[model samples]
Target: MIGVDWGTTSLRAYRIGASGPATDRLDRPGGILTVPQGGFPAALRDAIGPWLAAGETRVLLCGMVGSRQGWVEAPYLRCPAGPAEIAAATTAIPFAGAELRLIPGLTTEDEGGVPDVMRGEETKLVALAESLGTALACLPGTHSKWARLEDGRVTGFATHMTGETFAALSQHTILARTSVDGPDVPEAFSRGVDRARQPGGLLHHLFGARTLHLMGRLEQAETRSFLSGLLIGHEIVAAASGVTAVHLAGAAHLSALYAAALARNGIAVTQHDPDLVASGLRQIGRSLGWV
Candidate 1:
């Protein structure tokens, strides 16, 4: 079976064996947004054409590929959903030589009753639910998610635009002029996290980066990491209440940053590979009897 994690800016395909582990994988930058003239079919062919030619007959896809703006809208499943619920709602499409299935996203509400949703993260959550049973899981990205899973079901979740905000401020604001792109400075990052614990709140703390820079106390190269820590630190303080440990799933670099921030707050961290998307798609496929 071919498992595809087709997000907005990247496309990743994995060949899952009958037993479970992925046998091979493919990755490309031709995400939905990069597809030419809505040529999703062609893009898929370009990325995994050889795998299909090798006789792979079934495909399971997750992520933005199922978004309203994607190839086909697979609609979201309301929260308290699990792999069974996702499998039951899987949307199938027939390609030239294979059967393609798409997993639906998950949605839940905050304390204010405002709705929040996720697409690709649901697949990873399925894998997390199976492994951790009940836990708090964090998938940090452009829109980071803090999900609560109980007995293998996603009960509730919250979203924070930490990464997106960091990017915007670092690239589009005055902060950009003072920011430097380089490896994260742990000391600077930790200092930002410590500042987040203080009273003035995120908005006020955000300017602290600039103030320190102007005072020549914070070097230009460390500005970005400090800003990153401030945002991530505030995000954790605001969204990670009551959870003792967080199961982080995503790129190692981003997850490492979140893990460090969480650790400073007395939260233990268990990191999982972002590649769980492949295992997750396979699990859902088996549940649906489609593998």
Candidate 2:
């Protein structure tokens, strides 16, 4: 079986055997946004062409590829959703002599009852259920998600624009002028996290980065890390309250940053492999009897 984790800017394909783990993997830059109209099928073929030729006919996909903007829109399932519910909601599309299944996203309300939605991450959560059980899970990226899982079901979640905000500020704003490209500075990051806990809000604290630089207290090389820390710190502080521990899934660097911020707040973190996307697709496939 072929498992695809297709997002907005990237696509990953995993070739899973009838049993055991994925035997091979492929990655491509032809994300949904990169593909022209009516080209998703061709793009997908190019990504997993070899696997298809090898007679791997069953394919399960997750993420933005099932979004309204992707090849076909797979409607979202309401939360508290589990593998069984997600499997029941899967949408199958016939393509290239194969039965392609797209996993639907999840939707729920925030604490204030405003609607919230997530794709891709739900699949990872499904893979994580057996290990993490009922717990809080965080997946940090352009739009970071903090989700509450109970009894292997996603109960509710909230999104934070931390990564997007950091990118905008560090590349498009005045802060960019002072930013330096280098590895993260732990001290600078820690200072930013500490500042987040002060009386002033994030807006006020953001300016402090400039002030510290002007005063010769913060170096140019440390500006970006400081800004990152501040944003991640605020994100954690706002979303992680009352949760004693969090199951983190994503790239190692990003997860490490979130782990640092979480630890500073006395919250424990358990990191999971970012490759859970394939595992997740397999889990959903099994539930649907497609694997």
Candidate 3:
């Protein structure tokens, strides 16, 4: 069986045996955004055609590829769902020789009734839940997710735009004038995290990034890392309330940054491999009897 994690800007496909690790893998920039109006079939065939030709008859897809703008818009499955529930909701896409299924995203509402949704992350979270049981899981990226799991099911979750906000403030705002791209500065990042616990709000703290630079207190090279810490710091404060530990997952560099910020907040962190998506796809596949 082939497991595909296809998102907006990237596509990852894994050929899994009956058990154990993936036997083959493929990574491409051929994400949903790059697919033409009616080119999903071609794009998919071009990427996985070799495996298909080699006798792979089933493909399970997750992520933005199931989004409304992608190949087919799989509806968002409600929370309190596990692999069984998610698999039951899988959306099937007709193809020539293989059975292709798109995993549905998950949706939950806040106390105020505002809805939050996730696509690709659900697969990883399901895999995490299987290993860790009930826990608070964090998947850091452009939009970070803080999900609550119980008995291997996702009970609820929240989304934080920390990464996107950090990018905007550090690159497009006045703060950009004082910041420079450089290696990670642990001390500067720690300082920014500490500052988040100070008085005033995030808005005020953001301005300080600029004022400190003008006052010669914050160096230009460390400004970006500082800004990152500041944003991630505030996000942790908001999303990690009442939690003592987090199961973190994502790209190595971003995960490291989030781990540092999470640790500064007194939260225990257990990092997981980013490839949990394949585990997730496999788990869901079993439920669907595809493997």
Q: What is the TM-score of each candidate against the true structure?
A: 0.93, 0.94, 0.96
Please report how far candidate 1 places residue 39 from its true position, in Å.
2.4
Could you arrange the candidates by TM-score from highest to lowest? 3, 2, 1
Q: How well is each residue in 13-107 modelled by candidate 3, as lDDT tens digits?
A: 99986689998999999889999999999899999999999999999999999998999999999999999999999999999999999999999
lDDT scores of the candidates, listed in order: 0.88, 0.89, 0.92
How far residue 134's Cα lies from its native spot in candidate 3, in Å, is: 0.5
Q: Rank the candidates by lDDT, best first.
A: 3, 2, 1
Error of 1 at 237 (Å): 0.3
Report the candidate with higher lDDT, 1 versus 3: 3
lDDT of 3: 0.92
Model 1, 127-243: lDDT tens per residue? 888888889999999899999999888999999998989999999888898877998899999888878888998888878899999999999989998998899999998988777
Model 3: per-residue Cα lDDT at residue 24: 90
lDDT of 3 at 22: 90
Candidate 3: regions farther than 4 A off: none
Please tell me which predicted candidate would have the highest TM-score against the true structure.
3
Candidate 2 is scored at a TM of 0.94
